[model samples]
Structures are given as structure tokens and as C-alpha cells.
Target chain A: MMPAALSEATPLLSVRDLTVRFRSGRETVTAIDRVSFDVPRGRVLGLVGESGSGKSVTALALMRLLSPDMAEIAGEVRFDGRDLVALPEGEMRRVRGRHLSMIFQEPMTSLNPIASIGNQICEPLRLHLGLGRKAARDRAAELLAMVAIPEPRRRLDQYPHELSGGMRQRVVIAMAIACEPRLIIADEPTTALDVTTQAQILDLLRDLQSRLGMAIVMITHDLGVVAEFADHVQVMYAGRGVERAAVRDVFGHPRHPYTGGLLRCIPDFDGDQDRLVGIDGTVPSLTNLPPGCAYAPRCERAQDDCRIVVPDLEAVAPAHRAACFHPLEFAREVSP
Target chain B: MLNYIARRLIYIPLSLLLVLCAAFVVLRATGNPIDIFLDPNHTPEQADVLTARLHLDQPILVQFVIYLRDVLRGDFGDSLQFGGPAMPAVLDRLGATLELLAAALGVALVLGIFGGIACAVWRDRTPDFLISTIAIAAQSMPSFWLGILLIQIFAVDLRWLPTSGRGDGWHLILPAATLAAFVLPNFVLITRTSMLEVMGEPFVVTGKAKGLSAAKLLFTHVFPNALNPILSFLGIQVGRLVAGSIVTETIFSWPGIGRLLIGSIFQRDVPIVLAGVVVVSLFIILANLIVDLLLSINDPRIRLG
Candidate 1:
């Protein structure tokens, strides 16, 4: 990990009190509540959480891809210096896929089935870079090659249905990086692929990040992925940030009880655990969350204070913070 | 692809044979065509001669065998009323029907697809509500009633178009619009449903994330993906329009094959009636073939097979 002082300079993307609420009929549910984090330049920030933890919503909000009538987002999304939340949609369109791009989950359904692979990749090139048809076509083939696709020139003329799941994902990655954006938000990018393919995709992403020097907000539920790829990590529970720290600090000295529970749940093949430990309950519904803390009911170290009052995320160690009145003590190193 | 087309072509003759048999059986059951030529002045011997000369005196099976042989040799007997070969007379009227069909189809496609896009894009809003309501109303209305209504409003009251008959482009407005109204509702409903489903697809969001403008995303991404269902529906509509035009053509007194078929049926003109049926069915079959080809072109997933 980089030294704290060296990584403390202005982040490439800084989100502050970012909130997203979805309105249906008369009721409004907060999907993301005052969530905040920073993605330093040329670094990966893993936003780890289970399903419905607002990770995907946070990614879409950052890109302003959510429909305004359904989702109401408020707060700051400062990218490189401009307040993206305040940027007009017309101007924001220019920033998206040019300076800030995204990679989505489920590569099987994320591409236009009717369009040729070449055309899909060329779309972003021509739209953002204003390249002509021939130039875009040439660039698209190059991008396919960049993603390590074999016979890139021939693959360009094929459709999504003609390619395998892993190959399609490579195309999606190529599209995301067409303009060499400064940051890429990858939301569960490998969740739909098989074990070996997932590893290969992650490896490809890591290689591209290091080579291109672009920041990434890696949103995933797999702690193994975070440990392997993310430089900094933030854990979320029921739409709120639960803990924030460097990857080593999070795994070595987990401060939040929820975070401790998550760590214990990861199966240890070498340790001879017969069964994996599991968190006791499901995530609370966003529309009907408890008054004090959403995770208090399922937390092992829940106290009266935890039940009655929600704890704010506070500094527990240097560059580490956890939202708990009784933060876990640094007992042992558990890096796997 | 060539093999697929050849396979599809093999089925046409078999279908046409079935259609011809059904037409022959139905017309024979409707009473002898010779009876329509009879009067009080005819003697019994003269009636028998008339029946034998027209080959109506033979058994139904023998008559069908002879009719099938003649049809295979490219021979449909002269029209009993018009005194000419039935095939040419029917083919002559095909141009008018095709003209009306083309005009109505053009109108339906433009209005239905755009209206559907508007409805899907503005889902749950005033435009969606209004367009859906109109589509439902249009779908429920009968073609003949709608045709008359158009004539009364545009031709009678406003005097903007002719009341009936085929003439210049001005004369086509009422009939084509009426025919279009019959199929337009289906187009709107199908397009709207297909478009709505596609808009929710992950690729659409992918397009949006690529910084594509909303219009580009809709036309290039959403609309093309939604086109498969619409194209299939268009095939069915073409067949319906050919048959449904009988009513519209009658209302406008347009000199199309539909009007000719109606006139021949009343006159008990068996040759002309059979010719009209075969011609119309052939058109429908060819239309379905074209639609299938277009579908394979539009979506590469459908490899003609």
C-alpha cells in the first residue's frame, strides 16, 4: 500500500454526502444515504457489499444514468475538480465515456444483440472522439486487440450472440476504455462469469489499470476480489458506509462488527472449516429500515446504544474508520 | 440460405393445391352456375345442352379432375359475365388493390411506429395515455363503419376527397386512410410493447452510459432491437389487409380484385371467383416469404432456418 501521506493528495474522484432516493407512488425509499468515499489517482477503491446494499445504485448515480423522475440524487460527485452532480446533463454527456466510463455486470445482456461487435465499440469512439467511420473502425479493432481478443479483425464483424460470455465481456471492457477515461466504475464486472473466466477478467482489469494509470471504483460483494485487486476498501450495509480503510488494514484489523462477520463468513479451504459461517439475517428493506442502525439486529456485538442510536463513521486508527460505538480492537492479522 | 429459400418455395404449390380444392368444393356446393343463366323461355333439352357444354352435367369428382387438369395447363375459362379469360381480368384489377395496400401500409407504418416510440419514451405520461386510448378505440372499430365515417366527414361534409371509386391521389385518401385505420392499431400496440421491453434491456443502459444522445440511443439501439416482433406482425397484417380490403374496396367501389371477387360471387361466375381466390392467396404467401427474408436480414440470429 502507498504511504498515507503520499496518498493523501487530492483524489481523482471525491464523493461527499451522496444520497439517492427512489420515489414510487406516494412513498420514497432511500437507496443510498450520505455515502462518501474517495478514489485516489491511479488507484482502485473497492465498494464491497451484498445485494441491495446500494453499490450498483451508487455507480449509476455517479454516472447520472438513473432516470431523474424515479431517482432523486443529491450531493457532491467531484471528478477531477468539477462537481458532476451540478453539471448540466448536456455537459455531463461529454464527460461520460470520455473522462468517466463504466463497466457493468452480466455481459451476456449488456451488449446490443443485433449490432456487430465492431459497430458497438465504434459507437463510443465516434461519439466522444468524433472519429470518422474508417478511423473508428480501425480504433475498434485496436481496442479489441487491447483486450487480448484473438483475431480481433474478424471478431469485429460478429454479433454478441456469436461470442462467448467472456469474449463479450472483453468487448464491454474495450468499449469502456475506448476513450481512455480517467476513471472507470466497474459494478460487479465478473459476477456472471465462471471461476476461471472471472479471474482472467480481473487480471485483465488490473493489468489495464496499471498500464493506463486510471482510477477505478470496483463495486463487488466478493471479499476475495477486494483483497486481490482493490487498494482501498469501503464496506456498505443497507445503503450506508459501514467501514473505510486500506485493504490490508480492513483485513488485518476489522473495526466494525459487521465487517468482522463478513470476514468470518469467507470459507477457509486450508483451515478445515466444515461449513462457512454466515451472517444471521438478510439485508433490511430500504423502505422500512430500523431507527437506530440497519445492521444492529443482525450484528453479534449489538448493544443498547447500537439499538437506540445510529453510530456515525468515525476515525478509529490512522486512515481507518468504522461506524460503531464499540469498534473491534486490532487483535490479529488475518490476511489470506 | 439458398437451401432455406428453396425449402420454403416447395411448400407453396402444396398450399395452393389445398386452397384450390377448398374453393372448388365451396363453389359447387353454392348451387350450379348454369342456374343463373336459365330463364322461363328455356326448354328442358336446351337446359341439358347448356349443362353438358359447361361440363356441369358430370359428376363433381370428374368435374374437379377436369378443372384441376385445365388449371395445371394455365387455363382458367373465360368469365361468364365479362366474356374474357378470368386470369387476365383478375390480374388487371391487381394493380389497383396493390396501390391502395401500399398507400395504407405506408401511412400505418409511419404513424404506428412513431406513435409507439413516443408512447414508450413518455411512459405513464399524457402522451402514452392518449396514444394507448386511441389505439384501443381504433382496434375495436369495424373497417366498414370507419370507412363510411371517413367518407361522410371528408368526402361529404368537408368535400376534401371523393366519396367513392378509384381515380387520382385525392380519390385514394378515404379508402387508404380507412384501411390504414384497420391495421394501424395493431402496429401501435405491437411496436409499443416491443419497444417497452427493449428499453428495459441492459444494452439500452449500456448505450446511455456510452454518452449517446437519447435520440440516437432510441433509434439505433432500442428501435432496431424491437423490430423483430414488428416485422413478424407486419407479415400477418399484409395477409389480413388483402382479405380485409374486400370490405373497404366495396365501400369505396374501388375497381380492385376484391370488388371483382364480390361481383363474381354474386353472378355465380365460378372461373373469375376461383381465379381471384388463387391470386389473393398467392399474394399473401409471397408476402410472408418476403417478411421472412427481411427478418433474417434484420436479425443475424435468424439464419433463415
Candidate 2:
């Protein structure tokens, strides 16, 4: 038997060399390139990137929700000592909802419009747990209350359209946690909400993660949310993770040029800078990517070598890595 | 919800009035039926009698008023071909038409929706292409031709069932199938497109992420959202089926309202023609109203609106 301490140290979910490519006509585009990370028990790992950085695709791939016909997925998704990528679909279904759940970006569209909020939440309970209707309904009511929805009983019969965006998202979260999943992959869960509601939802998620002891993969482009909630951070550029480290290390010493550029884009409250810094150039087309580092064209310090050799993730610190030929030194990092 | 229905109901009377006015003007302008009723060598007295009987000698405006009054009072006048009140003659044959419509609709909807969902689920694959080709063929073929072909194969050649006329349940199958085949393509295409659209929606992604089985996700989540457009298309299809039965019923010699309508038209039976138009129009309006009500019930957003 494994030691208790060793078992405790093992991450709940570990992804290695995850790659996803989409095919359209004759061209194949890599949406997620060699993405790898870990979500330890009861910890929050924020996956941050701009649009088209494969952040959403990574989450979808982790859930095995992407269409097999359109996307060709490779790599290992090891969850609880099981290799998920190799699991048959029938087996995967059992893992989903029971062990893993995902909250989508748009709350308005995530919940089934025709279904009542309670029914949607009760679905996973009924499907995975095989609970009878009455038991499921009672549990659904409990979940509504757990998500902090007022008048949970009355709201049970209300459809998704009848609920506000914030309320709808809470219903989505309630549904995600209905079967008490061990891990929840929330893809931009607050992107559709207002600022106040966004903060509240994030706070709720953090609180729920602690209470339920469920690890979370929070996929978002908002670094602010990442800073406040994430225990570890993975910064994606193009289709690959350019930097992966503890949240403080990622913010305090951003080694990848892409990560440093992204940090500079964030506005400082008391800083006298006239304008927030912006990353130059757009993301290269996935179908026709450059041979080297995807960010080489956009990196201010791009050398001739940076344009030719694809950099593999190299350790900059213990458990901290970056996929860049010329990583920023500690002195050159934007002061945290 | 009741208020929304009431608001929609207001359009019914307005539409009926317009239909009636158009039918009256067109019928009057087509010919002086009194002249046709009399021979060229006939006496003036015969002409006078025909004119007075039809109330055509009155001013057009007065004639319209009388016609409207008679219609309101349920006197659709006499059917020149059927030897009775036009309304009763039409209603008598209505049972057969309704039966045929119900059978055809059942076949069309079941096949169409199931076929559409299958195509969407297996999209871009061989099954999708195969089913789509068959649907297109079914849609393009003329119902009357198809009916005859079915009769040739099933009734004439195989001698499995009766060729024409309606009595036993078995007699209804051929005509119903023909009608169903004619309308099935629209249902299949509409349902497929609607389902494909909903399949791409974020909620469907959410449904899948919830670990729902493929069948469950499609039927429970995607199907309901896709249903609104399909239901609206179904309303129109219902009306089309009613109209289409005219051809199918005629070919099958099914003794339906459509056959009676054709006989009345041949005899220049003004009352029967006008009554048929108004009744069919009413049916169309009712179908639309039902579709709207069902849509509102299924989709909460429409109810809220």
C-alpha cells in the first residue's frame, strides 16, 4: 500500500503532452499543443490566455467533451490513477458528472433554456446517482440553497430564461456540483457577468472548492481573477503553455516574454504610466504556424535563434518552467 | 399567455374578411353564371329566373351584404352539384379528409423528425448523405405520380390492398403514405437544419459536459430547442397537407372534401367554392394559432414576452 503522505501529495488530475488538432477541409490546425499541467486535491489552477490560445479547448479535452470526428486528441489525462484519454466513451461517461464536471463560459446559454433550473441541477444526481424523482428534487432544492439562491423552492420551477445571468450561473454551478464531483473545470465561468457579479461568483467558487475539497481548473483570460483565486498559473500563448508555476512565482517572476507582455498589459492602480502596455502583433494562424516559438514574432527580445528553434519547457526554478529560448531574468521581470 | 393568444386571435377575423372580399370579387368578375345557365336560344324569362335566384340582379354591394348575412347565419346556399346546402356537403366529406390528414401527418412527423435527428447526429457521414438524398427525392416527386406508382406496386402488381376508395383501415395506407412522402422532405430538411443549429449551441456543449449520453443529450437538450422552428414549419406543413390531400384524395378516389370541391368547381357551384375557401382558410389560421400556443408553452421566453 502507498504511504498516506505520498497519496496525499499526488495530484487529483494530471495532464501530460495533451494535444488537440482540428481538421477543416485539407488543413489541420493545432488548437492545443503539448499542453500539460496538474490540479492537486482541493487546489485551484487557473489556465489563463487570450482568445484562440486553446484554453477552452484544453478544458473541453480534459472533460473529453470535444467532438471526436472534428478534433483529434492525443496525450494522457491521468485522473485518480486512471489514464482518462485511453478510457472508452462508456467508461468516460461514468467518470463525467460523477467525478468530473464542467461549467461553461456563457451562463445565459449554458443552461438548457426549456428546462427548469431545478431539473437541470437535478439531472446529474438522477443520472449518475440513480436517485428517484422525489429524492432528486429534494437534493436539487438543497443544491439551490447551497448555491445561495433565494427562495430555492420557488426558483425550482422557474426556467433558465426566468433567472438573471448571475442566478443562471449559480444554477450552472449547482448542477456541476450536484453529484459532488472531485474536480470542476470552469471555462470562463464569469465572462458573461457584470463586474460585481463576477467577483461574487469567483468568491463563491473559491468558497465551494474549499468546502467540498474539489480541485478546480479555472480557465479564464482575466489575470486579475487568476491572481486573486489561483494557487498555480499556466500562461498559454498560441496553442501551448509558455509558462507554468505557482501563482506568486508566475506574477513575481514571469520568465516567458509572452507572460511578461501580458502582465504589462494589466493597468496598475497608482502607476504613472500614461497607457497600459500592449503585446504587439496578432496570434499566428494555427494552420500555418511558424516553426519556432509561436510568440517569437511578438516578443520584443526575439533573436535570430528564437525564430528558428522550437523551445521545450525548461525548468527555471523548482517546479517552475517556461518554453522560451530567452526567458526573462529575475532582475528584468516587471516588479510585482 | 392568454393575452398573447388573444392578440394573435385578433388577426383571424381581419384575415377572414380579406379572404372573403377577395373571393367574392374574383368569383363575380370571372363570369356571369346566369348567362351560362341559359342557352343562347333560351327565353328571357329563363334568364330572369336564374338571375333572380342567384340574387345577381342586385347591386354588387347589396349582393355582398346578403352573402355576408347568409354566411353569418350558416346558410352557405345550395350546392349546384351535390343537391344540398354547400356547407353540409363540404362538412360531410370533411371526416374523410381529416382522417387522411391525421394519418399523413403522423407518418411525416415521425419519419421526418427521427430522420433529421439521425442525420444531425451522424452529420457529414454516409448515413447523413444517404438520408438527405432520399429526402430530396421524396420531396421532389409529385404526390399523384407517387400515389399511382404505389398503387401499381402494392395494389395492382402485388395485389396486397385495394387500389382506390376508402372503407377499411388498409385502404387509407396508400394515399396517406403518398401524402406523407410528398411532405416528408420539408419536415426532414427543417428538422435537420434546426437540430444542426441547436447542436452547435453552447447549451448542448453544457449538456455533453454534464456527461449525458449521446442519445439523452440530443433528445432532452438539443431536440427541445430545435423543436420551435420545426413546430412552426409543422404548422405550415399541416396546411399544406390539407391542400395536398386534394390531389392525393382525387387520385385515390377517396370521397373526401377535396373531390367534392373539384365536382363543385366543375359545375360552377359558387356557394360550394366560396364555402370551401373560407373553411380551408379557417383551418390554416387555427393551425397557426395552435403552433404559436405550443411554442409559447414550450419556450418560456416567448411566454415572458
Candidate 3:
């Protein structure tokens, strides 16, 4: 990661201590607990986590799409000096799709099968921009072309099922950027695609982000994705952020034990003649999380103090933070 | 596509065979049409002459074969009661009957879909509750009884519409409304349940994340996905509506196939009765084919890869 002086710019969006809990039967399950992060303008923030790590929850909370009956949320989401959580629903709705939009993981069902691609893309334009039908449709075609779909004009009449999976995902991306939002939160955008298609989509996103200069929050469980594109990385575990810093620092230093364990889980073809390693145990059940440090039972260096007290996210060095009792100094202690 | 059409084509003859077999067995088992044809009190000479002339003296198998052969050649025989060829009379009445059926179904479909949408969108609210309760009540009530009540209110008391007969265009209203009511509830329940379920699917969630407003989400995303059930239910409902038209048509004195069927039943017009049954069955089979074609047009997943 580049030094702070070279990258200094006011962050575009800021999130703090965001917690979401759902009540089921007689128990309250905390899904996202005290997760905080920032999205610098024109930069990519990768939120890497395993399933049930609250990465999706954090992204959804950004748009206030949580089921009203099931989940209760508490957090400060400051976007351009405004508290998004405090915004009225009508205002929030206007802000959504126009200012903050998302590209969902699965393009298959995300699209309306009956509607022509034109109508689906032009929907937000008509709603938010108040564009008339003709203008909206024209813009929809333009967006299709912008997404590199061939024969944009003719494709407008076609239904979603007419297109392949990769094309549909591109159509979804076209819709996501239809309003030219400042932040595009793509939630595992390639999770449902083949590897070759995944690579193509990732390239498209990076190219679009570079050209358009929108802040992107790339949420994924794939460390490889973060390593490739993310300017900054935040590793979340048990509904909270365990490590956050410049991408290189987090991977090169990897202060937290859980972070190190997760990194080891990703297969390294560049080194090691052996088979891939793995982290033990599934994600802890949200309904019955352990006290203090949620990852303590799984941590290799955990001791009596680590078990008793949950460590706070503290700065171990400039612009690098971790929630661990002992930071790994393997690189510093061992000569290259 | 050709394979599908071929399979469907084979069912046509296969269906006709089943109908002919049923007609033969049921007509024979109920009462010998010959015995009914000749009065028992008739003199022996008269009965013998009638039996020999009509080929009643022939074996049952021979009679069935001859009857099946004539039917295949489009000769439905003469109506015993009407004193004319049964084919022309049956075909003429079929046109008017089908017209009424089509009109009634149209009314039912438009109302049912709109009502279902209202209920699904409003769900558990007053409009939804009112529409559902009314539809269910209308469904549960006998169409014949409901038609009688309608005649009593709108025809006899209020004198708003014609009371009976297909004398004027106004006469079709009461019978059509009654039939529409009968078909309404099934479509209402099916469409509403399907729409609600589709609304809960993950795609709808993804749609919301894309910032589509509530209205677009309902009409475009939710309603279209909900169309499959409605299409499937259409075939069954049309079949039932045509079959159930009998009592309602009789009650309202509507000049439809159902009324013709009843009149033929008392006259012991065997050819006319068989024609009526065949006509109704054919319509049902055709409606199912139309529904299939519609499904293919609406959903790509149904096609063989």
C-alpha cells in the first residue's frame, strides 16, 4: 500500500460501530457488531469475510434494506456529512439508486423476467431523475452500450432470460451505474459466475471504477479478489472487523491471529510445495456467541487474558489496526 | 417443438377413442336406447319392424362399430326427438354457447387478476379482506342458486336486465355474470398466492437493492414472475367453466350448449347427447393446448434444451 502522504484525501463515506440484531423466538441474535470502516473517493474498499461474518449485513444497512420486522440496527453511517440512518425513508429512497446503489451477487433472479431490459434499467431513471419514457429509454440503451453489451438497441426489447448469465450480470451492472452513484456496493458480484466470467466481470468493474471514479465497496470472502483490486482491506470475523489497514500492511503484517489463519486458508501457488491449509471450525452460531473475544476459542495464541477480555481495535502502528493481544512480528524478527 | 406437437396430436384420437368408448358403455348401461326407442306397450309387429329397421336387432359390437364409423365421417345421425340431422343443430347451438362462454371467461379473468393484485398488494388490509371473503363466498355458493337469486333481484324486482331467453343482448348479462362468479375464486386465490410468494423471493430483494421503486417492483418484477400459476390454472378453470355451465344455463334460460344438453336428455336424443359431450371435451382439450402455447411464450425454461 502507498504511504499516507501520497493517498491523503477526505474519505467519501464513513461508517462507525454499526450493529444489527434480529429477534427470533425468545433470543436476540447479533449479526453485525461494532463494525466500522471508511471508503475513500475513487478507491476500492474490500470487506473480506466468511459467510455469517456480517459483511452482507453491513452492506445492506448502507441502503436501509433490512427487514423491518426482523432486524434492529444501531449505527452511525455518515455519507457526505449526513447521517444516513437518521434520514427519512422518502429522502433515503431518493438517495438510493441515485447516490448509493448496489450490484447484487446473482443476476439470474435479480432481473424481472417479463420486462424488457430497457424497462428494468430505465426504472430508476424514471423514478429518481423524473425522466420521461423516451429519455429514460434512450439512457437505458446508452447504459447498455456503456456496459459493452452488443447491439444495445435491439437488446432493449429482449427479456432477461434471453441473455446469458454473464450478460445479465452486465445488465445489472448497467442498472447499478444507471444513476451514476458515488458509491457502488457490489456484494459478491461474481459469486454466481464461472471463473472465466468472474475474471471478466472483475476486470469490467475495475475499468469502470477507474473511469467513473466512484467509490466501490467490494464485499467478498475471496482473499484473491481483495489482493488484486482493493486499495484498503478490512477483515471481519464474528460480526466485527478484526483487522483493517492498507492492503499490503494487513497481508504483509497480518497482526491478528484470525486474520493470519484466514490468510493461510487461501491456497498459495506462489510458495509452498504442499497442499492448501485451512482454518478449523465453522463460524460460531450467532444465537449463542461466546463472551469477550468471539474468536478466542479458535485463536492459536489465545491465553487467560485473551479469554477474559475482548481486545478493542487498537492502532498497532500508523494507519494499521488489529483486534489482537499480540501482533505477529515474524517478518521483523526473521531476516529476508 | 415438432415433437411436442406430435405428442399432443396423438392425444386427439386417443381422446376421441376414450370418449366413444365411454358413450357406448354409458348409453348402453343406462338404458337400451332401443328399448326406449320402441314403447314397450307397442304391438309386437310394430316393435319388430322398428327394431329391424333401426338395426336394433344387431349385436352391440356391430352397432358400436357402425356408430363409431359414422361419427368419424362427420355423420352424428338424426336426433330421435328433433326429427332432423343432429350435427347441424348441435353445431349451430355450439357457436352461440361458445360466444357466451368466451365472454363470461373474459369477464372472470379480468376481474380475477385485478382482484388478486389488489389483495396481494394490500395484503390483510380491508380491501384485501373484502375481496377475498366475497370471492370465497361467491365460489362456495351454488351457481344455479346464485343465478336464481340474481334473476330475483336484478331481473324480477329491480327489472334492470332481461329475465330469460337470448332474445336480446341484455339477456346474456345475468347468465354471464353468474358463470364468471363461479370461475372467479380459483383464479383469485391462485394469482394472489403466487404473487405473494414471488414477492418474497430473493430476486425481489435484489430488485430492491437496485433501487427500483415499489410500483415498478410490483408490476414488472413481481407480477410477471407470478404469471406461471395463473397460466396453468387457466386450462383447468376453462374446462370446469364449460362443464359447470349446464346448471347455470338451465336456471337462467340461456341458449347455450348446456341448456341444449338438458333438453336433449329428456328427449332421448342419443346422437345429440353424444355430440354435446364430444364438443365440450374438444373445447377443453383445445383450451389446454392454448395454455401450453402461452406458457412457452411467457417462460423460456419450459423448452427442452
Candidate number of the best DockQ? 1
List pairs with backbone clashes in candidate 3.
none
Per-residue accuracy of model 1 over A86-133 as CA lDDT, tens digit each:
999999999988999999998999999999999999999999999999
Could you give the candidate ranking by DockQ, starting with the highest? 1, 2, 3
Which one wins on lDDT?
A: 1
Clashes of 3: 0
Q: Which ranking of candidates, highest lDDT first? A: 1, 2, 3
DockQ of candidate 3, scored on C-alphas against the true complex (2 decimals): 0.42
Per-candidate TM-score against the hidden true structure: 0.95, 0.94, 0.85
lDDT of 2: 0.89
Q: Please write out the lDDT profile of model 3 over residues B94-193, one tens digit for every residue.
A: 8668877887899889999999999998888998999999989988998888888999999999999988888677988998888898999888888899
lDDT of 2 by residue, A12-77 (tens): 899999999998788788999999999998899999999989999999999999888789999999
Quality of candidate 1's docking, in CAPRI categories?
high
**Could you give candidate 3's per-residue lDDT for residues A83-134 as a string of tens digits?**
7888877777788888889998889988877667898888888888899999
For each candidate, the DockQ is: 0.85, 0.75, 0.42
Per-residue accuracy of model 2 over B144-184 as CA lDDT, tens digit each: 88999999999999999899999999999999999999889
Answer with 1 or 2, whichever has the higher TM-score.
1
> Per-residue alpha-carbon lDDT of model 1 for B83-186, expressed as tens digits?
88999999999999999999999999999999999999999899999999999999999999999999999889999889999889998989999999999999
Q: Candidate 2 regions off by >4 Å?
A: A1-6, B36-57
